[model samples]
Target: MSPSPSSRFRQQLIVAPAVLGLALVAACSNSSSSTGGGGGGSATLAGDCAEYQPYAGHSGTTVTMFASILSPESDSLQQSWAKFSSCTGIKISYEGSNDFESQLPVRVNGGQAPDLAIIPQPGLLAQMVKTGQVKKPDATTVANENKWSPVWKTYGSVDGVFYAAPMSANMKSLVWYSPSAFKKAGYQVPTTWADLMKLSDTIAKSGTNGSKPWCGGIGSGTATGWPATDWLEEVVLGGQGGDVYDQWVSHKIKFSDPQITGAMQTVANWMQNPAWVNGGFGDVKSIATTTFQDAGGPILTGKCWMLQQASFYEAQWPKGTKVGPDGDVYAFHLPAVNPAIPNPVEGGGEFVTAFSDRPEVRAVQDYLSTAAWADSRIKVPNATGWVSANQGVDKSLYTDPIDQLSAAELTDPTATFRFDASDMMPAAVGSGQEWKSLTAWFAEGQSIQQTARDIDSAWPQ
Candidate 1:
């Protein structure tokens, strides 16, 4: 569906020179707790209300939200708040994405939490619900206005109550490459797992003529092993199919299950081979800034043929480079890893959460539910490559062709889209043991069996 007039106009405003100053203000203020739900009134349970016409003229309320590091997505959030304020006359406070995760708990425990929050990790939201620090949506009221997908809704549920609303989602099982290079090398896109491995082998063999086949970087500080974990999960999903991966993430299956072992063994075999990755794969930290930078380096310099990453990687490309003929950039769905399983995509979504029990907090939630607000707030011109999770928004909002393609892939019904398995696991397994163990395996030559055991040990009891 096409974006509304207000959304289109807001997109123009965000790109105007005058609006640049407001961009900083919008991102910083809208993301914090200084904006909505400030006063004292019992939070109302708005049951199954299809459209919330917030009590008119509620100017004193504040809605604070937190998100990850700023990028194109930040522009969308800001525009959303701007539209929300215009519609309901409410103010919003915003903050950096990383700040909220650490700061929210301390403040909530101290009784100074914001009314609303957008957490990137579901495990954190789960903790909030468990501690009674957050409130469940009035199901009758929420169900009336918004219908959520089973995948999105389930992530925010704890004991049958929904605590958060999912915003935007991206497809992760994609490998981006330069079409020009592919054409020059006479390579054909492979559709199945066996064919994909053969393609990689062909690219590797071509490297003898001085072209590297793949661009693999495992560095992101503190999150160093994430890239590798993506490879592992992709392979596992392909090798054992989604059902087994789902069981593993939900803790129904052990990390050391035979299927998982085989997946890890596949990764070990690939990394151990000198041709598959660069020399620094074993030494870099996953979260290190350089890791992201390196992933794009090979492509920019025409050294490597492909880089497998999520849609967000487009924002990280070097300044002034465009995709296609004008720019050497393009992406394809990560080829099926196993011929036996259906080709499903893996990725994650961002959600908005609340810590306040005030009436105005619901107003902010209602505002976010509107397509007008989402269209205006999320279509940042500078962030040309981000795909939105909101259904029926204008595809024209995305300027980059690759972003457009990714968005189309996400909406395909035949494709199975699941959250990144590692990220979906409980924090101990998702962030602590699993991340550290994988990095250790790469850098220190830690045994694969021990790494699997370490991950298994960290699973929540």
Candidate 2:
């Protein structure tokens, strides 16, 4: 089976599927009480469903959604629509599976497609659109999409026709560190890529609070080398800037081009350096064997001080873990090569698309595209590490400091936000060779030249 991005941003593998059904009860506060589009929501349930009035009149309807998002986040997503389900009498049956990426294609091809799917990769979404199975969005959804950044609409579109709406977003351009450790060590977060390098060197010389400067693992089952890809991506986007990065992704430049190899070398200098990495694990080779899920665990024991990962990593910490500048763990923006380069924050998110165009499904799709739904989703109480690019969302509702930081970076008008390159690239190279070759570079000591050459050769012929 083709590897699905189901494990790209989320690399944790599961033996039993993390499937879930909607409880369908919700209460949350939002500044946008007016449901901007769609029809009325269910009026039968408790709490304020006024904002969901646009989705109303579908009381007897049910819309089944399939996606890669798992347990806790799935719970928040299901709860997000509780009020809508209550007010509109719509039953939103949601199922989550790590195999969603691989299974979605089979389901669609086998004519077992769900009412909707949360496509985490734009490339996969493009494939679904090409199959002629995914339905185009309704006018309301198109209008709601118009409210987002053009970059987002472009991702949800193929050949300039809109088919899906952007869902939740996670920031990848982050370096996670124990805040208390940093403070105790008197190490300030770096503000530029050069400063970041210097900080790494400084920490390698003496370690952080008596622990190694970094901990890393690329293991995500079949997606072993993806974490390294994220490293190279941000380095390219920040070091070479967006235009060059875009050219590389589109194949205007070969994967073996000097620019890309240079980025890979940079990753080696940091992550593969024995002195700087495998802090809590073992030698550099340990990274290949370490699961991304367990890579950051050493930070808790003070064996590893920092790990570069996405904002969603907040959920990786054991329950009751504190996250903030003054808390147990927090993240700082991975800086650009220089202040002159616009911060190119690499991010990942889902596009909500449907296989059937039932009125209720259309209503759900239209509602998802609206800011009201974005607000509702983000307003899931006690849910940490949630961020949305929707301009209409109230950022103040983000009680988690990391969520605030991520949202500020994601929604910043001046920032150059790029979708994950591997997710957007053709799968032959992105999921196959790039992953395989990068892991060799880390585990087998393959040189940047060889890794780049291999991946370049693997690009769809």
Candidate 3:
């Protein structure tokens, strides 16, 4: 089966030219007496429904949701709701669309908005809050997010108020490879960025069937160059450290700043090398035309040894392809540049925000915030790419090794994690010039310095 629209659109998030800023409001705080876990709702609540028994009286109410989590993920989430529905009788009607970002405002403006929405971009969430399209999350929900890493709380907050809770997350700092091929070639996983480059040199020189060491593709139709953005983000997180990364995302640092241009040049150092990228596709420019969905294929065919991508890239592999340390395919964390910087995690996730504060909606939100819900989400099952950052979630529940590692990376307290920066910038820049400039830089032979300057110039005044 072809990838779901949700999977495809996951590469791109919508942006708008809103004048509002997140500084305008503060994040919401916990108000409920319940702890991070939803307090038991009913005195008679027992067994699987005990935690949610208190919500039994709210059964007649309905909770409607809008989001971009389509297909297998949506199916598993729906099945995971069995216990919550059984206990609360709150009927859930979720509508997943490829156009959620665009359609959301229309629904709100039309006064036909759902009770909740799974917002993918914090920037967009801030815009919605500014326009009064989103409601503050209740204390119970806030408490749950509070228990997670501060990054989750920060992403869900607009200004000082928290209005959303993290639902699902993925790790982007990964380099996929074939375990069998690596074993045959006597290659070991690199633990540091320097070691990774050294390994790349070895592979390129070994010339396994005259193949290259890396494969990459940035093509994504109108969203082309997003994967390229991921490369820049990963390198920036490593090269400049997280504090600078934060400033860069908020536009406190100009795109033309040395940090950015330096990072872009670092990307050019490898990607622009004819011996490093494009693998079976021929020249470096072919990376501009190769669909990201097809970029990993060369790794499987032994034409390339590695492809840098996010954990979700597991879905792009042919069905039933084995994935593990000993399986046909496996992925290792992209090693850190400076070990003292703490391993930087480049990833993204969905934030659950409410449009309505109805009791039923609150109950649904409360249940979702609980550990029971997080755990159940993985157990409900499908082809496993699902993982949770919830400290309460058990990594063993993830059947796929990729999902397990992704979760571990997210839950790693010492890890320096940052959301995708482009998704957090002003629409005119993030989805506009940043995408255009980077594409031209790689595909059209534009200078990295010129591309950085061009993108900096496009930042909204």
Candidate 4:
């Protein structure tokens, strides 16, 4: 089984920034803690600060950040830097708003942009760069980023200038199910798409006591259909591979193109198949109405057996619900569709982009890009549901079982990651028509061809 996604990470990856918050809660606390403040001299800090010497001496400087992450996750983010923040005496103030994407441009154009913002989409970051308001990363920050994979550097860059540091990442190609339920039903985890479908059929026919083999929800307030977009993106990515996936997102091929529509047809067969879905909920239309937050809950009561969601869905399970191979709920990778497709993992992440090039701000950005910070952030006390694309993160630091699972798959050398397509698409489509049209696919029984046409028409010509 695979690990988890933090909708919190997803919100940063997307909410609308969410469909990705479709991402989820982070991991739980269970790691070593030590203190060393002020040049490795005090016992008041959270972790080692030696690598941070060059960034120190900014006492009383406050670097401000703005993003879509809220509450506990936001709080954990603050703590992730507690040691660095303390060592440097640089206060990092944060502002989290549900309306960040809309308000950020307003903030930028008004000369009130944050020192840096955790931009969720490259598309949005590209817009910020176009305004000439967002600053390129400083040398130290860029140097730190150089240590990560070139793919991450590309996401943070526009054209070619590196602007943001890839932050928290979430894997969406995951299927959540109850371990005990599978054990009770005498089943094994499916590794290929054919077997996955077969397992669904096997469970559906074995008598679910009126429940089904799978359950799903596309609901997320205004982001209602974004979850469904994940369904199509994964099909395109896992079944078709990267070149085709890139062409689809860039509009080199239309959504109406068979390559794109073909994926949607796959979604229809799986999710829209009446017998396979709305497992714990009502009929097909209910998916459009059921909140993604509640989609995986039925797995606990044995009302449903499987839910396809990002790793972050771990945060949605009821408290006291154990989440391990031996626990009540656990997730496995969504599984490979074609043996020809090198492990394709569909995922998303936030980027640390700046409007201010102040030394303090860049210091923070540089820290986030470093392996030290990557490990630090994950070790934040009680933090849950987060994965960093940084290859530097120590797999062993992730003691939690789910974190171990997600980190393992994310770091798989053979896995090719395709960022969430809708999140990167032009907002008019990714967050607009594509969303509306996909919702219609479920709610109004819109045909895949028509749905594809509706979304294609919304593409900016």
**What's each prediction's clash count?**
39, 17, 13, 24
Candidate 3's residue-wise lDDT over 213-310, tens digit each?
99998776555677888888889998788999989988898878888888887788877888887787878889888887789998888889899888
In angstroms, how far off is 62's CA in candidate 2?
2.9
Give each model's whole-structure lDDT: 0.60, 0.77, 0.75, 0.75
Q: What does candidate 1's lDDT look like per residue over 224-295, in tens digits?
A: 566667778888776787788889888787778888888888876664455755523322222222364367
Better of 3 and 4 by TM-score: 4
Indicate which candidate wins on TM-score. Answer: 2
Error of 2 at 365 (Å): 1.5
Candidate 1 Cα outliers beyond 4 Å, as residue runs: 1-56, 86-89, 97-107, 110-112, 138-141, 144-147, 208-211, 279-289, 324-327, 395-399
Stretch of 10 with least lDDT, candidate 4: 16-25
- What lDDT would candidate 4 get against the real structure? 0.75
RMSD to truth, every model:
7.6, 4.7, 8.4, 6.7
lDDT of 2 by residue, 254-335 (tens): 8788888888888888888888888778989999999887889999898988898888777678888888888898899999
Q: Which candidate do you rate higher for lDDT, 1 or 4?
A: 4
TM-score of each: 0.81, 0.89, 0.83, 0.86
